[model samples]
Target: MKIDLDRSKEPSLREQICAGIAERIRSGLLQPGEQLPSVRQLAQDLGVSLMTAVQAYGLLEKRGLVESVQGRGTFVRERAIATEASGDPFGWQLAIGDYLPRASFWSQSAVRLPPEILDLATASIHHSLLPLPLLEASIQSALKQAPQSLGRYAPFQGDPEFLAVVAGYLQRQGLSLSTHQLIITNGTQQGIDLFARTFLGPNDVLAMEAPAFSGAIDAFRLSHGHIVPVPVDREGIRLEILEDLSLQMRIKAIYVVPTYQNPTGSVMSLQRRKALIDFAVAAGALILEDEPHRELTLADKGTGRLPPPLKALDPDGRVVYLKGFSKFLFPGLRLGVLAADGALYRRLLAAKSIVDLGSPLWLQKALVPFFQNPQLPRYIDRLNSILLQRSRQVADTLSRRLSPAIRWQRPQGGMHLWVTLPPFLDADSLLPEAHRRGIHFLPGSIFYPGEPESNHLRICWTNLADAELPGALECLCDVLNEAVR
Candidate 1:
């Protein structure tokens, strides 16, 4: 019953006491049906507060170690004792039961490929396009400036300097938001999870576009949300379909990628954006607006400027906006910003604190200099130009080589293209042969929540080197041609 307490440790006194007793229980030093000291006795013996002893016992009970009988004493639970004889070590895990959603497609998308394979599946700018030297320099600068940040924990919301930089950055993009309205996430993935956990519950309705970002689909589903798929066309998610859905059920939240949406590359028009805001306001549903590729505008003056984000029109704070830096900029940083206001913002902030406390302090500090640099906008402009050229090259190759039945819209700004194959061909069935030919792609079925459209597949033009893109596209086109023929 003797537990040594370390005063200078990071864990509190209560945590240390729990750990010490829990270890003893697990190691069979404290046997099943054994009655430990009472909370008052333990506090007196250990020279600690009675509250600390009570809290430690409470933690032990939570871990299924002990139980208290009425008017008696606290004794170890019979099932708490570890078995000395073991066969299958991991058999205990089976009792935990499975609650996670099916993530087969999402899992496969992250597999490592051979060097010879032309990777058109991952939606990231080519490594050469990223400012690696700048990133490295920023890291060194961060360490030199704030050496303690490496050893310190960041603020729950974000680093103040980084938050200030993000505020100005968002302001430049026409969204007037203060640092208080923002939470810096590990990435847009984390942002989606935070919002889902904060607002959604079991059987709560979450409306999302069919053929949406797979990550969002997985996140909401993991939260046990009953997802309703709305159709997306040239404009965006069909407003009429969403309105009808609102009538049928109380949707807790709507997730949309309005500008340069993933996989589809469809930008919600200005009119559609306004209607969507109005829909959310009327239905009393929150909108999760994911704008990952908004900054990478590939269109010039000929196609006209793209509309501002859905957040711009959301004066009522009905929208939780996520803007990702991983797509067009440095993916390795895994940096993104989440913007919300009032009560919802507080809820998301609390959820984020539970998730990871905060994103890495070192990375957050490193990003500040990068975001503050005057040349950042120039670098993005150059990156967009190259991506635009690559997109045209991909389009040209497809048009020249593929059958007329195959169709795709060249997106104005985005990392990937959503190409629809002929009805006779399924991207899933075609993927194995594609891999055999040293090419890789993401089949479109993975992007849907319910029944998926197997005829479509997403090809990211940003992954391959400029020199290698032509050959890769040629190889892909040949595969599609042979399939159709």
Candidate 2:
């Protein structure tokens, strides 16, 4: 086996050599039980010291990738076998390195909890608040009108009718787009994955908000792109930092959740949106604008209309916009629209075809009438009313129950409240007690791409029933209070 070591690289010779061997084994280039070169031989081949070769092998052994017996050379370990006593029978699969990306933190946090536990971590609306009657009527009407959609596969781009509906819907929101520019995705997450597969390559620089969505972090990581985190404030991502970094290294794409940003519900100012577009044009970079929570506006009419989306401001077609309904509407519908143009649009459509043929034709058919329903806007307004009340209750409770050291700003929209703790307190360390008290929250570290800030957590105020909310808030506050004491 050949192990290439670059002395000029940041990794030490020992680490490079170790990683090379481990990759070879995982990729099946080195068969199980194959004998490895002797340490002296490896050193001589690679022109490294014998001590370095020994250290490399030691690291591989520690990783369970190799084993050495007395009076014999090192050999690759055989696949882990299941035994009656072992807890994990599928452990052997770990070494295969098939390389499917998993969002471990998101998966672990989203596990099914007991009925007694209040799920403050779930960023979804309560069932009672959903427009059940309206949705039922729409689905029944769709079944009567388009029964044949169930038998036929949807077009690779999307259902033509659904595309037309979504195009019109976006036009009302200030994003004028034609039917051909839109593709129906299963959800925004899938749209993000499509972008990653279509545009991102290894070592491509992706600049995103520091405390961004956890799922996006995982999706971008799957592309093996080097993510650069830019801090967010009341105005959204700090462009100055991104501009400075661009000078240091080429940034291929910028990802943002501009309006009603996830975790922290800050909106990017209109001027900032324009500036961002300008920057993208000047730098020749693409902007991936994710607007999943924009429609859940909780502010009063006095707050005026929200800023137009980044795509609305872009005349250069540099922005790829993704709008999802799963957050505020029917989550089971798993519906969203992605708008793009030019070569990137064609590539994304091709990627979607490979991903799932198309997002479910029947569901797309159901959404057409729902999108056209006259009562839809009123229903959204009603949802915001109840959500506003719940958000206020949460903010007021935190103000009264939490220490001044613990802080959070009342969000204008969206389900989550980004809470910051004193620097000495770590949110992850407090999670177990939070769970024991029958409440759950998402630790802030999951939202960050690298070197997370441990002093923050995200709590959603929308998932609990109105009656369960006060008690849930009390339980959450009690954990924080006790921790502070």
> Which has the greatest TM-score?
2
What is the C-alpha lDDT profile of model 1 across 312-418, one tens digit per residue? Answer: 99978999999988987878779899999999999999999999999888888998898888878888888878877777888888888888988988887888789
Tens digit of per-residue lDDT, candidate 2, span 270-337: 98999999999989999999999988998986879999999988887889999999898988788899
> Looking at candidate 2, what is the lDDT of residue 78?
74
The deviation in Å at residue 79 for candidate 1 is: 42
Model 1 poorest 10 in a row by lDDT: 79-88
Off by over 4 Å in 2: 1-88, 100-102
**Clash tally for model 2:** 0
Which parts of model 1 are misplaced by more than 4 Å? 1-96, 301-303
What are the models' TM-scores?
Answer: 0.80, 0.85
| CA-only RMSD, every prediction | 14.5, 6.1
